[model samples]
Target: EFNEVFFDGAVAAEVVGGEGDGWSVAMGLLALERGVSTLVQQIGFAAELERVVGAYVAAGSGDPVLRERLVRQWAELRTMRWNALRTLGTTGDPGAPSVAKLLWGGWHRRLGELAVEVRGAAATAGPGHWAHGTPYELGLDEEQRLFLFTRADTIYGGSDEIQRNIIAERVLGLPKESR
Candidate 1:
């Protein structure tokens, strides 16, 4: 694969990126599920984060309190990703993948919010209100319910279109694209 050749074939996990369907921690989840190592390096800002800290400390530009706050946020986000990896490799409620999905699922429904969160940039939304609902309310049959509860095979939490959009935009990072 191009990525393997580009990275010298050391990649054990791949963080899929796009403007939608961006299950941010999915690669880690995949790594865990496939028994691959997630610490193979260069997973997006993962490699950059420490350098960012170093640069900030060296430059000494930002306020100490502000830096501390940003660090805390980064810690929270990192922990969330870690939890996802942990869940996929575990069993039942002990896995706690649903908790991660519950939190991340909301982001898929609100791309504008994610744009703001990730890039501090404003983004517009289509004409639909998004809110989490139970599978029963969504008219999901047993199969869908089983899929939803298990967090298996996918990392989305809505209609097929919404799910596909999340897969397209976030996971694939395709901007303003269709199908």
Candidate 2:
């Protein structure tokens, strides 16, 4: 039933030429979850990585400008997977910060890359263009709604800026700057 609905919806969007946006991202996440689960069950961790990387590439291919952004998104997910594995490997016991450091470091670097992508896209596409609809013509209520919802991506795993700070301080050993 779920697969039926999912496919039907995707077909409808294709027929209508829907402006790929949040809905596409949601579908990608769902596919990633399912792929990861199947790979974990059948082939284990290494296979799971392969599955995720493939999924990431496919997702990124959706938009040329968004490709690098999606790659960074994939990297963030991979880092999360690494952190989860490390925690499990430690048997829930604390040890050297090396594992956490590596995870955070990777996350930070990816966040920086994503930031650049976002800024570049924004410069070319302009604000509110990242989602849907034109920036100048959004109605008041629509504008407010989009403003709130568009933030969902940045906040979801972690804000890109926060991730950047982690990379700079812990990974790069740079002095902290006040926000």
Candidate 3:
């Protein structure tokens, strides 16, 4: 049986900034324990994952195998997450309001794509990805939690570039740019 765990801001912060394998594993387990119904609540969790990856990259740990695995895992997870958000978008149930529907329709897609980009960047940057110091310094648990968490932001709903184009064309009604 699965239970839902509501993450307060502090817990969220801890999850995002945790460190090492132990913290990473614990965060994953916590997420899993929350079951599939909590996808909406878990958006922050996904963002945390992105931050964690940034931290790992910054730490100067030259583990190519680990990095590769992280990239693959993140991609797969992001796809699943995007699908979930997209599913939420199509449903107009009162429980799923229009604002959330609209947000999922585009914003979430962009985030998913961003996750993919970060993953690729992490791989390309390798150990040097975060060599210049990370934007924030989360604890080890939060760091690990975030690293593995953000894998799905890029590929599932839409990519960052795609989302930007969408906003330009649809919301702003700007003319399409030529490739």
Candidate 4:
């Protein structure tokens, strides 16, 4: 199940960004990934936010708490967009990527939460009743799926703790956490 590459020679000509410059190249790519990719994700987030807003409106639940949370989510999305743009334009900020990651991860996870919460108790129910077929055969609806899938958004690329550590040590020039 494993294979390996054999570079019989120096392969200097095949190196990217010249020889011994891999770190800078890697960081550049990471910057694009964290900054540009976040902008792309924001488009989808906008749609998701709209959907949540739609659900909230349709349900007509005059819950001030949910309304406040929804408005805050919208505002945060805008803030994240501007932050990502700032990170994209800046250089020499090693923690920029981490900040973007943290911003979107938690924002998206909360969006998922809001998606289901807007739908209320029905969010927990599958698309089909158990009497129609086995429960596993009945898949989740959009809100349900959103709620489940976004649970990992904060965990996959990096956890909140890791992002905070990157900000603390790299961006703020604080002392490193003891391992």
Candidate 5:
């Protein structure tokens, strides 16, 4: 589902496409997400991201202060190519994705933390007011929910440990860790 964009296109006046295996597709999705994030950092916002932000600002429906804070925080997101160059000795190398993924995990986590903090709330504070003592009731507001979601960035796509290992073995040519 996620990698469809990479597979489909009109070639020579003919639509062409094919599905990729799950693992490869998932990996591509992770890389795509990181690339998009970096692009957004470089170009402010565009396409869907731009549309979302603009809609919020136009309608004045979302919290303006939070929006501004997020804009600033997003601006601080590391340049993907720069970080990749530092870690892998080159940009767009095989190891770049590993480094980018590692950075993304931390970046999203920090964005979540900062966004919630800017709103004078603790994102780490336990479930919001809801069915008290109920396991199903994990209290959280929108921003905190976002924080919780981004906290899993390290584990999703690929774990930080995995990315580190990729960098060590594939990029740095270190030996694989013993099982």
Candidate 6:
């Protein structure tokens, strides 16, 4: 189900907020959604950070690079939480949601990468045995799953580029990019 499409264009329905206003409605909702969801997401991120730290500790490998990365990740997590709290309940800024999205999207993806890296080479391999007649079986462990799934973190809700554009144009008063 890695490439599973949750929903396609099969179910057509009338727009609730009115025709031609879908973008506006969606943006308004997204602004509010981003504010609230980020706080919840920080909890999950904190747990994941602990898991990564546990892996690092259990390994007993003092690779300075990873140690520094882990510390940086912790700092970034704190920054993300503060950013979310700072922007919460504020509707005056148009790019606040995009800012939040941009902050956590990259951070989560990096955490996924860190999760796999903390496990070293062993994290790359899956179950060695095949099932039935199939030569391949999908048996990704937690770290592997996290690494693979977070690849789309920046692309799903709004891509990093899109978020940057939003911040540039809406927040910074920059000119919009040409279509």
Ranking by TM-score: 6, 4, 5, 1, 3, 2
Q: TM-scores of the models, in the given order? A: 0.31, 0.26, 0.30, 0.82, 0.52, 0.86
Best by TM-score: 6
Better by lDDT, candidate 4 or 3: 4
Q: Where is model 5 more than 4 Å wrong at Cα?
A: 1-72, 81-92, 121-139
Pick by lDDT: 2 or 4, better one: 4
- The whole-model lDDT of each prediction reads 0.42, 0.44, 0.47, 0.86, 0.60, 0.89
Candidate 3 TM-score, true structure as reference: 0.30
Better of 1 and 6 by TM-score: 6
Model 2 Cα RMSD, 1 decimal: 17.4
Model 6 local distance difference test score? 0.89
Per-residue CA lDDT of model 6 for 108-173, tens digit only, reads: 999999999999999988787664547754677878888998899999888999999989898899
- Across residues 1-179, which tens digit of lDDT does each residue of candidate 3 receive? 22467655554336544533555575344334323443654466466556646755866665676567557646755765665565443423222222222334344344444444444454333342443477443323333333344444443334446556655665567899799
Q: State each model's C-alpha RMSD to the native.
A: 19.1, 17.4, 18.8, 4.3, 9.7, 3.7
Which consecutive 10 residues in model 6 have the weakest lDDT in total? 1-10
> What lDDT does model 1 reach?
0.42
**Regarding lDDT, does 4 or 6 come out ahead?**
6
Tens-place lDDT digits, model 2, residues 1-179: 01223354455456433655655565344334333442243233234334434544644545555565556555655665655554443322222133343444344344444433433333234343433565555433322333334445344343556556655776678899876
Question: Which 10 consecutive positions of candidate 1 have the poorest summed lDDT?
Answer: 118-127
What ranges in model 6 sit over 4 Å off? Answer: 1-19, 130-137
**Candidate 2 lDDT:** 0.44
lDDT of 3: 0.47
CA error at residue 74 for candidate 2, angstroms: 1.9
TM-score of model number 5: 0.52
Kindly give the stretch of ten consecutive residues in candidate 5 with the minimal lDDT sum: 44-53
lDDT tens digits by residue: candidate 4, 1-179: 23456657768778889899977897778777988889999999999999999999999998899999999999999999999887776777888898898889999999999999988999977655663577655567778878888888888766789889979987899999998
